[model samples]
Target: MVRVVVVDDEPMVCGFLRTILGSAADVEVVGEAYDGAAGVEAVRRSGPDVVLMDLRMPGMDGLTAIEHINRLPDPPHIVVLTTFDADQYVLRALRAGATGFLVKSTPPEELIGLVRTAARGHTVLSPSAARRLVAASTDSLSARDRAREVVASLTEREIQVLAGLGEGLSNARIAARLHLSEATVKGYVSRTLDKLGCVNRTQAGLIAHDAGIVEP
Candidate 1:
């Protein structure tokens, strides 16, 4: 089973998420928290595989909670499921080690899928959230230039793999698109992440976007 913890300031939101996630036989909502401090505590207590977190709260806030949770030994994967998809929020969450950024407006089925994806150690982002990040990239010339420099250090094959990541394609999908073995694609992804100084696929994907490989 994929154990999960839901963290939102609204009790209704937490209950709603529990209901939605409960429908899946493979998923279990193990804990819920109404604020960031409690969210971190819940994570420590439950040791869940994934955490669905909200941004605005009475104290600590989602970004701070994410950083705190990330510092835990063998921390769970966190996905920010907030109503806000602002550029700064997205960047902050990801930079703090969130495995995904998703707005509450995401479809129920898609949200469930994203939770599962995070449990598997892959990056997730709502389509609209991704577009916002891409837009933010265009507004910052320095970020774009730095991204290009990073890309320049990569091989052509690694660049192709990164483009696939920016497009939100899984390893199997990227392999088929590039006509390479999935194992080969996985190696390329690891190398790309290393070259870009990224901790996860989401960061590499953002770099790909900033570099104009996936385009806005």
Candidate 2:
């Protein structure tokens, strides 16, 4: 089972998440916290496989908590809860080692699926969040230039893999798309992350989007 913790400032939101996640046979809502500080504490104590975190909270916002949790010996995968208006926070959280972000209005089924995906060590981004990332990239010329320079180091096949990642495709899917084995795709992804100076697939995806190597 995928163990999970729900962290949000609002009690209603926390309860709601717990209910939906609990409904899944393969998912267990292990804990719940009403603020970021408590969220961090809960994560450490419960050792959940995934955390559903709200971006804004009364004390120690989600971004700060994400940084702290990521430094732990065995950190849980964090999935930030956000709204479209909080796109900036979403990006910051991702940079701080969050596995992904989900809009607050996300359908219950998709939200549960994303938690499962994160537990599997895959990055998740809502479609709207992905669009915001593309928009953010469009406005930063320096970032674009740097991304392009980094991407230039990749081979043709690696470039294809990176593009697939930008589109939120998994290694298995990328392999099918490029007619390569899953192992080859995984290697290409790791190499691409190293070349782009990215800590995870999410960052590499952002770079690929910024470099215009993949359609937004």
TM-score of each model, paired residue for residue: 0.87, 0.87
Over 4 Å off in model 1, which ranges?
A: 126-128, 137-139
Candidate 2 stretches greater than 4 Å from native: 126-128, 137-139
lDDT of 2 by residue, 1-216 (tens): 999999999899998998998899999999999888999999999999999999789888888998888889878888888877347777767766787888889999788888899999888874456657667743568768878988889999889898888888989899999888999889999888888777677777777777888765
Candidate 1 lDDT by residue in tens digits, 132-199: 76676435688789889989999989999999988889999999999999999999999998998877
Q: Which consecutive 10 residues in model 2 have the weakest lDDT in total?
A: 125-134
Where does candidate 1 clash, by residue pair?
none
- Predictions in order: lDDT: 0.86, 0.84
Residue 23 of model 1: what lDDT? 95
Error of 2 at 134 (Å): 2.8
